[model samples]
Target: MSSRTLPLLFINLGGEMLYILDQRLRAQNIPTDKAKKVMNDIITTMFNKKFLEELFKPQELYSKKALRTVFDRLAHASIMRLNQASMDKLYDLMTMAFKYQVLLCPRPKDLLLVSFNHMDAIKDFVRDAPSILNQVDETYRQLIEMYTALSGGEFQLIRQTLLVFFQDMHIRVSIFLKDKVQNSNGRFVLPTSGPVPCGTQIPGMIRMFSCTGEEVRRLQFPSGGGYTGALREGSFQMFGERVIKLGTNMYSVSRPVETHMSGTAKNSAQHRPAHQQC
Candidate 1:
């Protein structure tokens, strides 16, 4: 597995957690000040210099159990608390949402854009809190320095590593189902056609190059299914548009976050000792 996988996994999952928490806080009518505090505290803990230093280190990805413990700690870093059932549902939603994003990435390098989208939203969450914003900005710099220059092959490895981590996860999320992006069986439905990834043209014409690198001939064929031109590539710097929306918040007042407990998780819980159940 690529050592680069952990940062992307951690950042995107943290992003999803924030989206759900923000929506829930609003839905429950938590006071504005308190809601802001909860978000600030969690973001502060998430991007703490020491924690981030460790997180960005090249190392093996943590097992699901270990990673869940980390998020549990992060989630509780604020005064707000979640009971076991709520936390389980939150984790399922976070994991499945991110899994769908990873599965649908148009190009390996676009993963950076996804991460940037999360970072952008995180900054917005604390835009008025200069201190917290500073921490997030520092991490953003680190992300650019570390990932922007990596070759395509490196990004491919990172993408594959993430897929391996998400393998066998089939938690059903209501939002995805409603959006028609996920099937009843908990697997995502990949679209057959869409705008091609940035920096590539839609597939149809093939140009044959000669040994001297001259284009000898061009052949055009039928390319099916509503494909279109690529959108402009997203900015990779600290403050700019992240054109891709995969890692942005999906939940809002209208679209409340909800999940269905998968039979796999339910069966596993039934087998586990009561004390071990979450």
Candidate 2:
């Protein structure tokens, strides 16, 4: 294999170490036929370094001598790169660590590096124009479902994964929104005291906040009602509105009103607050 391929191979191997061995790796720049050859070379390098010795060492006695020896050896070569076999072993160890909450092994940076490397293929796959939109949409849908599932099932790992997932999605959405906004002439204004005509496309700023569970309530006044005057008061009321829960903590919709009034009283008050007060 060409020397140029070695870096990519290492990256791919490191990615595999992160426990994200998905089909996306097939989309990498390296041709499918050469992946195994590159992986084998990496494996050979890891094996020569005796990296697997510590992993295989006996833990039955847990003596200070054994612990000190292991620590000394690790201190000497703590940051060695892995070959395919070692990477596979690392993956197994990580899974077990997460499953059993084992003591510190790999650092968080190591795990994050592996995750980014593994995602390289997915990034490349979605970069293609034909699949970009579909991939982005599907990713968002998957995130929502994953969030709901993790929240309901109390899966800690899934919850942690969702945190990463949402963070990545937020970056993607920011990029997408910037591009969309730059191409359009209009600006986003948070709706105040009026009905948005049906079919009004929601802006990205609103959508981003909505996805993160921010409550957006729209209030409308009757025809011949004061617009600008009511708007100033309505804006204040918006801040105090109670968020209405729709279904089981998964969905919610809020309606803003003055704190003292019921929905009907609030609606009526909006039209004739002075008369009601009188």
Best by lDDT: 1
lDDT of 2 by residue, 167-263 (tens): 2211111211343521232222222333322223322222223666787655443444222321111111102211111001100123211111123
Give the clashing pairs for model 1.
none
Clashes by residue pair, model 2 = none
Count of steric clashes across candidates, in order: 0, 0
Q: Give the root-mean-square deviation of each candidate in angstroms.
A: 6.9, 28.0
Q: Best candidate per TM-score, number?
A: 1
Can you give the lDDT of residue 251 in candidate 2? Answer: 8
lDDT against the true structure, per candidate, is 0.84, 0.27
The stretch of ten residues in a row with the least summed lDDT in candidate 1 is 269-278
Superposed by TM-score, candidate 2 places the C-alpha of residue 21 at a distance from the truth, in angstroms, of 8.0
lDDT per residue, candidate 1, 89-145, as tens digits?
999999998898888888899899999888888999999999999999999988999
